[model samples]
Target: MFCLHFLVTSLPFNELKLGRRKYSERMYAERAKPLAQYTTEELYARFCFGRDNIKYIADLVRPKLQHKTKRSHVLSVEEQCLIVLRFYASGTFYQVVGDNMGVDKSTVTNVVKAVLVELASLVNEFVSFPKDDQMAHSINVQLVANADLIITNCVVKWPGSVHYAHILRESALYRKLRSNRPNGIILGDSAYPLLSWLMTRFPVANTPEQAGFNSAHCKTRCAIEHLNGVLKRRFACLNYLRVEPKVACNIILACIVLHNIATRRNVPLDDIYDGPEPDEMQPGQPPMFAPNEGQTGRVIRDAIVRHYFRLMT
Candidate 1:
């Protein structure tokens, strides 16, 4: 007992203390410099995403992101935005955001949630199907004037993996297209099974006639694939979401809205020449849920192959 007490008392107060970082030290000593210091291009090189997007989002949610306290000053809307972007860009932890920004982790948490909620509110405006009597998807964007338009819902909440064919039958947009414009045609890749409303290329173009149809289909379908490439290129978060599925869904729509905003403002998008998202090799045969097309569906498919593609060629 005497020895224990002697050792305890002998220890210096500093030696016995825990090494927790002070809030001010963290706030003031952040290693990651404030992004606002950089030019827009410099900022883009840093986050690689979300920096260009903030200008559009700020007016929408900046007011809501603000907090003020007499006892302790709150993070400004701009500060919160920088925190949110840094978080998404790096997929770094809240502690990293705090240490880098000189804010408490809780502050970072609140800022992101507040901003997402505000962004979510404007989703319908930016992310909607064409309200066209007909439609399309894989989250392709159609630019009009200066805004990004998502012609289909971009949700991964659908059941069963491997892009099941039946999912189309159960899809809301599919039904919308059918009811609104039954005569309208949609071009799809072989990953999608053919239906009356959706058309796929000839599986194996053995004959010249079949070859012509596949060529026409490939040329048109490549454009949407290219759209996917550009969209994913600009937003790194879409390539690999760090948030929960629900949050990811909102983020996806939020990005679509912002993409359009960037377009309207004439902000340069990521160059397509930078390359596409790396593809994952499927380990096994893709599971199939394709049911037989109806007589009408087959007739429509054949007519397009014969009339449209053949004539176009």
Candidate 2:
């Protein structure tokens, strides 16, 4: 039986020789697999997700508990900020964000919301609209005067609740602008309610001609849209969010703060517009506004924008 076993093993040697070539080829192919290319800075720039910001964000979100469990994961304020930024920039789902950050989906949701609440307070305190008379007047003259029109894009239904739109409008930033420019004429898309209640608050122009101008004017406001796109694209987690709606709202707010900061620091704009121009005046569509009337609003808005641009420059 031993001799038979030896003969059996030895008989396979001939077949083994034929298989060797296939095995070698497969091994070579495996070895030739392409390596991922990205340095830490490159990854951060592309993903907009930075470990450095984790500590700042974590501190903002950390609960004020007296006793802490030793086994608990200690997420820093900066990390929390990064998560929020990633969510807003990429619109990545919570589950995906958690997996990327090595945390559960629920944790990511909580962290993002908590961080936003905290940061929103900070943003209100520091990054506010022009309050002082001189600043407000300058903003009105420079930025507001130069633009042919003032367009305020309102997204009515965000993730969590219907009231979110009102909350945004009531935010300190928006309030400051509204109070300072009582006579300012603003334009919005059709989705928003043209309440008579708000008509006296500001001269709102929502006619078809005005809407067309607003759409054309969007190019100037594209900065915020780009900011949103950047946050989502950088963090793959935002692509498939599964967190509670409240948490998602917070994440969005936190990202807005980061976007503002980046803007303050003069972050370069991402050129994403390649579509046909909406403002291209159609033939036979009599110019929407009399040259003088249009010029008045344009002059005011442009002046406001230009002043800000100069300061930024």
* Per-candidate RMSD, Å: 8.6, 15.7
RMSD score of candidate 1 (Å): 8.6
Question: Per-residue lDDT of 240-266 in model 1, one digit per residue for the tens?
Answer: 766777777666666666565655566
Badly placed stretches (over 4 Å) of model 2 are 1-39, 42-73, 76-90, 132-245, 266-270, 275-313
Given candidate 2, what's the lDDT at residue 187?
30
Model 1 has an lDDT value of 0.56
Q: Compared to the true structure, candidate 2 yields what TM-score?
A: 0.45
Alpha-carbon local distance difference test for all models? 0.56, 0.41
lDDT of 2 at 230: 50
In model 2, how large is the Cα lDDT of residue 206?
Answer: 47
User: Which candidate should be chosen as best, given lDDT against the real structure?
Assistant: 1
